[model samples]
Target chain A: MELRINGLKKYYRTGKEKEVKAVDGVSLEIGKGELVSVNGPSGCGKTTLLLISGGLMNPDHGEVFLGEKNLYRISPDVRDRERVTKVGFVFQQFYLVPYINILENVLIPTIGLNSYSASVEQRARDLIDHFNLSDRIDHKPGELSTGERQRVALARALINRPSVLFADEPTGNLDDYNAEVVLKYISEFAADGGAVLLVTHDKRISRQAHRSVRMKDGRFVGDDTNPVK
Target chain B: MSLINKPGKRISIWMIIKNELVYKKFGFITGVLSLVIATSGFVGAMILLRGDTLATEQLFMEKERELRAEMLQLEDDYRIIMRNMGYNVLILNETQSISELEKEGYASTYLDYEDVWKIAESGMTTLNHLLPVLQEKIYWPEKGMEILLSGIRGQVPVYSKPAHLTDDDQYRSPIMERVPEGKADLGSEVAVPLNLRPGDIFTIRGEEFEVNRVYSRRGTRDDLSVWIPLDKAQSILNRPGKINGILALECVCSTEELGQVAREVKEVLPHAQVFEFSSLIAARADVRQRAAKLHEEILQAEMAHQMELRREKERLASVLIILLITGASVWIFVLILNNVRERKHEIGILRAIGFSRLKVLQIFLGKSALMGVVAGIIGCMTGALAGVLWSGTGLSFSGQGSLVTPPVIITGLILAPLLALTAGLLPSVLAANQDPADIIGER
Candidate 1:
């Protein structure tokens, strides 16, 4: 397994005496070359589960394992190193830094590792070209369309060549055609031998995945394998 | 083209800060402006304070010079007046009685002619302008008139004062003129009765003499005297190498007491007793001392007023500097804090992409430091210029290298950045410690 989780729980207190179970007793696993989508409605804990599994949030009670290493067991700095070197994240909001150009934004993850060089720059350029954003490579995010910004965000995520990719609502803000283009790129990442954990509310997104799980109120309600994969 | 390549370019924390500062131009500009105002205020205050001190010193020095010049001129004027009043001190033989000298108009006892020379070479500081006189009552056998035969050689220079070689002693001190050899100076009484004039040959005892000068009429015994060389008078009186009295003017330029003159003269010549015209000497000393005291009082009062003014200015400047620094620091803190709030999602995204917390901190802090460095340079220059202009017209201080000393400029350059870093510390930490999970999940 490339990514694994067992009984992850996260609770947020709403007031003095009331608590909301953002994610409770959620467990799942994803292997190499597999794209698994967690399907649920808004506030059903799909995003929370993805966040915990991505090594970003601490689970109140459970363990998240990436390859053979437990994500929460390591020191924060070590965890940060592991995340930068072995994992990638994409968001529905396409949070590209607005002041930097698209090429620089795609190369930002390389800066986190303090490892930018000629080869990294070449790779960033190649990725920008692959995303069909070569003409807009020097333009700021504010000058780009919604689809172009998402493409830039996607390029930034894949730049580090992480073993696993965690994406939250990756297509929630895209049009139908742009949504199809983004889903095609994600399926290609899985086919290229990368693990993908995608969380979304749309059932139609699950068809592009090798497997799908339904979650409600922070727990998995149903799990199934799609034959289309 | 393969996208211009932009060779040698690499992304780093500095690049992120630069881009962000450019993007948020309003916040960055305002932050820099506040720092400039504070830094300039501090530098200007320091320069003005130093310049004022230098100016006050220069003024004091000028005032002192003027007072000293005035005192010297007044002393010269007093010396002229005392000289015109005649030698205020007459040194006669120790055993000679004042009543006998007054009744006979000449001393019965006499001193050796070398006595005057002894006092002149003694380097006595209490007396100056020494003169030796030999006078006797004689009957002019040729004119058949009784006249006082006065012998005067001229004034002797005291060893303490610089030798005055010229006869132009009118402005300096009164000097008795020397009667030329083989010639006589005839008093008005003797000259009018004998109808003698300058250039006329006259006989004194058995010696033939030319009338070198005829004196104006005076109501004193000097009007009945015939002045000649000391050697001539000594020969006529048959009193060789003898003088009845030594005449001298008491020096009143020092703080020494009037009585000290007689004591000092006695120390030099124990055989001589000094008889000074105390009223004349006393008046000269009183006027000189009063003028000196007034000069000192004026200087002290001016200094006290200057010091009080400087203290008030310093207090005002200190208050202004404190206010400016506090206001600037608060503004910087608010600016960075607001910047952190506005970039909440951006920080979350950077963290999600695996940026370490330290790198995030560097971004915010580096921006603040850059602003400080730029403001420091510009503010120091403007402050120095303003100090010069203000001092030129206000403080009357014009000293070179007073405004932009190394210590003050260096302190200002270092202080502005330190202040900015201190103000930006809390906000930078907040930006660094933000959790990506909470921020990304909220969206």
Candidate 2:
């Protein structure tokens, strides 16, 4: 699937008198196997752009399309349905439910919505194993290392096998070694024909992207195609 | 964070509840306990608030007042009946007027008292469910001695009293005020000397009468004295209701109450001789005073008890209300709300991964409903058990004798879950309304 944005504009009220354009007429597209990165300083609206593209927020104007389907034109709930089956989010903070074990955390989205059989469990086990955290699969997030926690978050994000992966500053809290492992995994995901839209302030991350969009104050400043890629 | 790998999951309500129990044991247990307490309170209140079942003291006062009113009516009716029969009458204040009455040749006497015995014709039934042993106790007082009781015990010679006094006096001392309707005083006394007591019953010529008391043991003409009810004796002796002798009291107005009784008696016997026994009238007044005081005490006691019961009932009701409203519902709302706030980021991730708002609502509401259901069931069982265990006094549930009935059960079960579901409402909606974008962006 392709995540396509056209003139997407989302405004925010910073104060009673001030309205800030968080995503001001921004547009972009990330096709399957595309590893696109949005880079900016603080307040540049990269996160806002990522959110609107992922169907997590509504744009004041313009539209977001997943392939031929205009997500913003669809009903909010329908868009949510589209998101549940089609998109995944990896946050910098690794937002895992604290009480649930890693395996159950991975299963949280399926709760009361889907049935988990041996294959489902096996898929989750494979993800944990691929992340080199099989021994910690049943452990809670509190008991895991920072890298392990982020990996669990990654595995959880991919548990639905979303066609589009949204990673917002995913490696912002990770060390260089852990960040390298995360980048390699995200690169591998794009190699496997899954689209990845990564938002980061880190130049190292932007350099690794096959394509990069640089933003200043919610508008695109430049687009770069990495020479190596 | 996803429902991707397989066909849509069919998660049952039970599975959700099981997960809730596993995840939130303390909240679930507390919710249930509060519901149980509330339900039990309701069960108890139902019985306590029922009509037709008065507290024992209240019942006693009611019955005593009824019996007194009946006795007064019966006495008035009997005197009127006697006067209409063209019988000469003499009214006396004191019953012990043998000296004055004998001097006037109007003293009624009996010798060798003969007991008139009659068998029950057939099918004489009593309303008492505890009456199967009545016959054994009725005819042969010794066989059912424990149940043998005396309504009236008037001696024929030494202490003869008209027998109509028995019914109202059944539960009182036999010396209370009596009836004036009777047959002529028999000159011959047919005595039955046996080990029989005054309360004993005997039969003669298919007639039945309870022994009043052993007549004089002295070897005198009074030794044969025996007494029976005036109407029964008249019926047995083949005489109409008539009194051959009169005992009269010329009452002087010492109190307004005596003036009333004197006025009533004078209304029946216009020309009857009257004599005053001031001491006996005073004694009767004293007795009436004591009785009135006792009745007042009983009323006050019952009123006080009722107030206490009312207060207690209100307390239980208030507690139940609290448990239903603020206790179970509010506490659950707060707990689940805290969970939502604490899990804001987690909720955001779930939402981003495709969990719908409705799904989010379902999780929290489902947990609350489970809590309610469990609390309801446990409360119902324990409340019913409390009813059964305390049914000895009916104070546990429904102060009345009603058990934990069907309405109570239905209310307990339905109300608990409903209330719990209600408690979960805002929290669930708030949790479902969480904005994934805001939460994720904040992270």
**Interface RMSD of the candidates, in order:** 2.7, 5.4
Q: Which stretches of candidate 2 lie over 4 Å from their true place?
A: A112-117, B1-37, B44-324, B381-402
- By DockQ thresholds, what CAPRI class is model 2? acceptable
RMSD of 2: 14.4
Model 1 lDDT per residue over A32-131, tens place: 9999999999999998899889889999999999999999999999899899989989899999999889989999998889878888888988989998
Q: Which clashing pairs does model 1 show? A: none
Query: In angstroms, how far off is B287's CA in candidate 1?
Result: 1.7
- Per residue, candidate 2 scores C-alpha lDDT tens digits across B1-443 of 32232355433434444654676677667767766666666655554443223454456566678757855665455334432322122343234265855553333322111210000111111100000000001232323222111111231211122232244433122221232233111102233334556555665335565554454455533343334454454444443433332322222222344444334434443433233345555554455556666766766777778778777766776666665556666777777787678667767877787778877787778877777777778877776766555543623234434455678778888877887778789988998898988888774
TM-score per prediction, in order, is 0.90, 0.62
* Model 2 TM: 0.62
